[model samples]
Target: MARAHRYTVEVTWTGNTGTGTSGYRDFSRDHEVRGDGKPVLPGSSDPAFRGDPGRYNPEELLVAALSQCHLLWFLHLAATAGVVVTGYTDRPEGTMTENADGAGEFTEVVLRPAVTVADPGMVDAVPGLHERAHQMCFIARSVNFPVHHQPSTSAADSAV
Candidate 1:
C-alpha cells in the first residue's frame, strides 16, 4: 500500500503600501512564504509583472523543484548501482506561454546535469541512470508538461 504525505505552507502578502490594491500600480507583489521548521522564503511575481527582481518567483521555484527531485533520485540510484558520484550540478530551464488573458502554462522543462564519477568505467552508465531518475522523479511525474534530460558525465580526476 502507498503512504500519503502532506506539505503545508503559509503565504502572507507584505505589499500593502498604505493602501491595499487601490490601483494597478499602488501595491507591491512582495510576499513571504513560511513552512514548519524552514526559513522564510521571499517571494514575488516575475519582474515582468512589476515585481522585485531580487525575490524568488513561482516559475523559477517550479523549475528548481523539478531539478532538485531529479538530482536526489539520480544520486540514490547511482549509490544503489555502485557508481560512486563525486560531484553533480544542474542548470535547468523551463518555458512558459502566456495567453491573451494573462494566464500562462509551462510548455516544457529541460534538465542539464553535469556529473562526475569516481571511476572511468562508470561514465557510460550515467546516462541510463539519468533516464531512470527522470522516470522516478515525483515532480516530473506530476507535471503536465514534458521534462527532458541532457546529461554529461566525466571521471573524477578529469572533471573540470
Candidate 2:
C-alpha cells in the first residue's frame, strides 16, 4: 500500500516599495518562506532577474532539495547494508535553460558525492549503495529532468 504525505509552506512577499507593481521594476522580488516551528527562509529571484544576490532563490532550493533527498536515502541504505560511513559530502549542480519568453526549466542535476567509509572493504559497496539510493530517492523520481550521480569513495584512516 502507498501512503500520501502533505507539506505546507507559507510565502509572504516583503518587497512592496510603496507604489507596488506600478512599473516593471517597481517591486523587489524579496519574500520569506515560513514553515511551522521553522526559521524563516529568505527568498528571492535569481540575481539575473533583478533579485537580491544575497538571498536564496527557487532554482537553488530545488537543487538543494534533490541533493538532500539523495543524501538521506544514501545514509539509510548504507546503514542497513552494514557499511559504516564516516563522512559524506556533496557538491550538487543543476543546469537550467531559459526560453525566449523568459521562462525556464531545469535540464539536469548532477550529484557529486564524496563518501568516506570506515574500512577498505566497504569502499567497493559504496557505488552500489549510491545506485540504490538514486533508485529510491523520491525527489529524483518526481522530477522530469535527469538526476545523475558521480560518487567517489575512500576508506577512513584506521589509525585515527
Candidate 3:
C-alpha cells in the first residue's frame, strides 16, 4: 500500500521599500516563513546576494533540513537496534556553484555528525548507521546532488 503526505508553508515578503524593486538593490531580501502552530521563520537570500547576514537563508535552511532529517531517522534506527544513543550533533556543509548568468545549484552537501552512545560496544556500529540514515532521510533522498557523510562517535563516558 502507498500513502501520501503533504507539507505546506507560507512565505511573506517584507522587503518592500518606498519603491519596490525599482532598482537592482532597492529592496531587502527579507521574508517570513510560517507553518500552522509553528513560530514564524525569518528568511532571506544568501548574504552573497545582498542579503542580511544575520538572517536565515534558503541555502542554510536546506542544509539544516538535511541535518535534522538524518538525525531524526538515525535516532529512530538506533532505538530499534538498541544502540542507546545519548547525544548527537552535526555540522553540515554545502557547495553551491553559480554561473556567470546568475544561475546556481548546489553541487554537494557533507553531513559531519558526531554521536555519543551509552555503550562503547555500539561505537563500531555507529559508522554504518549513516548509510542507513541516508537511505531513509527524506531530505537526503529528495536532493538532486549527492549527500556525503562523515561520522564520529564515542561512548558517553569518553571524550571525542
Candidate 4:
C-alpha cells in the first residue's frame, strides 16, 4: 500500500470500404501486444491476430489480479497466525452480465473464487483467513463488486 501506478490504454480504429461493401476496423492497446504478429481479434477477418488469449482480455486480467492478491494475503495471514500452510490454489470464475441500468453497457462483475488450502492444522482457519484476506487484499478493496470466496480445506476442521 505504499504507492500505486495508473495506466491508460487507448483503442482506436478506422475503416474505408465501398458504400455497399462491408468495412472492418482494427484495435490496439496503447502499446502493441507481443505475439506472432499484430494483435487482433480472431473473430475478425484479420488472420494476423495472434496475440495470447489471456493477455488481450482486460476482464480476464482483472479476475486474475484479484484472485492472486487474495491468495497472497491469505498466505501472509495464515503464516502470522501460526498456521502451517503447505500450499494453496484458487480458481476464480468471473461472470459478466449486462448492466442493469439499461444503458446498453455491462455492469458489476461477480467473482466466485474457490480456494483450496493445504495444511494439517489450517482447516479451521479457512473462514477467518478468507475474511482477513478479503480485508487485506488491495485488489478486492479497490473494486466495488461482490467478490465471493468459497474456501475449502483438505484437513478436518478439528485439526486446527
Candidate with maximal lDDT? 1
Q: Write the per-residue lDDT of candidate 1 for residues 57-104, one digit (tens) a residue.
A: 999999999999999999999999999999999999999999999999
lDDT per residue as tens, model 2, 6-96: 9999999999999998997999999999999999999999999989999999999999999999999999999999999999899999999
lDDT of each: 0.95, 0.93, 0.92, 0.59
The alpha-carbon deviation from the true structure for residue 142 of candidate 1, after best TM-score superposition, in angstroms, is 0.4
Q: After superposition, how far is residue 85 of candidate 4 from its true place, in Å?
A: 1.4
Name the lDDT of candidate 4: 0.59
The candidate 4 region of ten consecutive residues with least summed lDDT is: 42-51
For residue 151, give model 3's deviation from the true position in Å.
0.4
Off by over 4 Å in 1: 157-160
Worst window of 10 by summed lDDT in candidate 3: 151-160
Off by over 4 Å in 4: 1-54, 99-119, 156-160
lDDT of 3 by residue, 55-96 (tens): 899999999999999999999999898899999999999999
Q: What TM-score would you give candidate 2 relative to the actual structure? A: 0.96
Alpha-carbon shift of residue 156 in model 2 (angstroms): 2.6
Scanning candidate 2 in windows of ten residues, the lowest lDDT window is 151-160
TM-scores of the models, in the order given: 0.96, 0.96, 0.97, 0.59
